[model samples]
Target: MSKIDSAERARALDLVPVSRETAERLDVIVALLEKWQRTINLVAPATLPQLWTRHVADSLQLVPLAGQVTRWVDLGSGGGFPGLVVAAALAEIPAADVTLVESDSRKAAFLREAARVAELPVTVVPARIEQVAAQLAPGVEVVSARALAPLSRLIELAHPFLAKGAVGLFLKGQDVDNELTESAKSWRISSRIAPSLTDRSGRILIVTSAVPLAPIKEAAGNAKGSTHD
Candidate 1:
């Protein structure tokens, strides 16, 4: 891997400042990611040069939005972007933990190693989202995803947790407006959109309530074909 520019790293830290301990932990994660990238595809090749600003800072920006919530679930935690970074920041807080859900075995292994090496409080769940969503939903305070799926599909995957009152913080790009419009068709979502601190075109979607809208055809059929006494 090529060397990261010191200036870029400085800029990212400036955007989301952290204590020395947290910075060191994040450094370990970045180093481990670079080492593992040679064997497995951890992140996009083009983004490596700006990894700190693009990935690290982008992930770190979610920490503050989370407030004091300690128990977090990061869905599709590929390369541990916001998951590991959030865990690293919360490592010192009491009872603070982040669960990284990644189905790919190799990536899961990397997440485990990164958490172990950084001594961050994290659980690496190596199962598909649907397989473990129920088991992990209870007691979760925050649910997050970065570049995972469309807002509509994401709601489906995160429904179990959202229904349980866990807030959803999803990182989206320029097309977020379109995704929200698409998601509205099947879900009544109470959400707020915040501009991302790291990218000009990026946005962070905060969803507090997501209720599934009954299929129009199903409702129509029930109204026309069924009668109750």
Candidate 2:
């Protein structure tokens, strides 16, 4: 990316004041992403060239909605995306901790290294979303995911957090409407779509309601008994 375009991208992201420190960290993030991309395929190859607008800025969009969140859980955290981006931003703010969850060990390693180099207080949890759900603190105030799962499944994975009254924010693409409709089939929830700050074609799903799906073991057992009866 050209120096001119980098400056423009920073301005568009509203990284006010643009401290030398902040600018340096942003550069490091891009460098790490470029290095890791060779092996893990973290982000879309086409999007790598525009990592500023496509990833960093896109992730920072959540910073505005984070109002007073002391702790946050990011699910399916591939290559750190919003999770690490938010962690870096939060360090500038007061009293915020970020946790990144990823099932892939390689991606988790990337998140761990990124968080360490950035000196951001981020916890990397290398586990599947469902397995890690029970360990999340009930007091967490926000949960986020990007391109992780359909809306309904996202809700299911986040049920523990929502049950404790935490809000859910998901980054979705053009199919958001279809995902919302499909989500409604299995869960009753309230949500809204906000225009993405980075991509006009993208939308953020702000969710406030979440209900657990019946356990698979229980649901299957019930089906079998009904059939026998």
**C-alpha TM-score for every candidate:** 0.92, 0.85
lDDT per residue, candidate 2, 76-166, as tens digits?
Answer: 8787777887787777657778998887778889888888887887999987777667679477888888777667667777788888888
CA shift of 166, model 2, Å: 1.0
Best by TM-score: 1
Candidate with the greatest lDDT versus the true structure: 1
The true-versus-predicted C-alpha distance at residue 183 of model 1, in Å, is 0.9
- Whole-model Cα lDDT per candidate? 0.85, 0.74
Q: Report the lDDT tens digits of candidate 1 across residue range 1-229.
A: 2566667878999999999999999999988988988888788877887889998999999989989998999998888878999999999998997999988888889999999999999999988888788899999999998878778888778888998999999888989989999989899999999999988999999999998897422111100000000
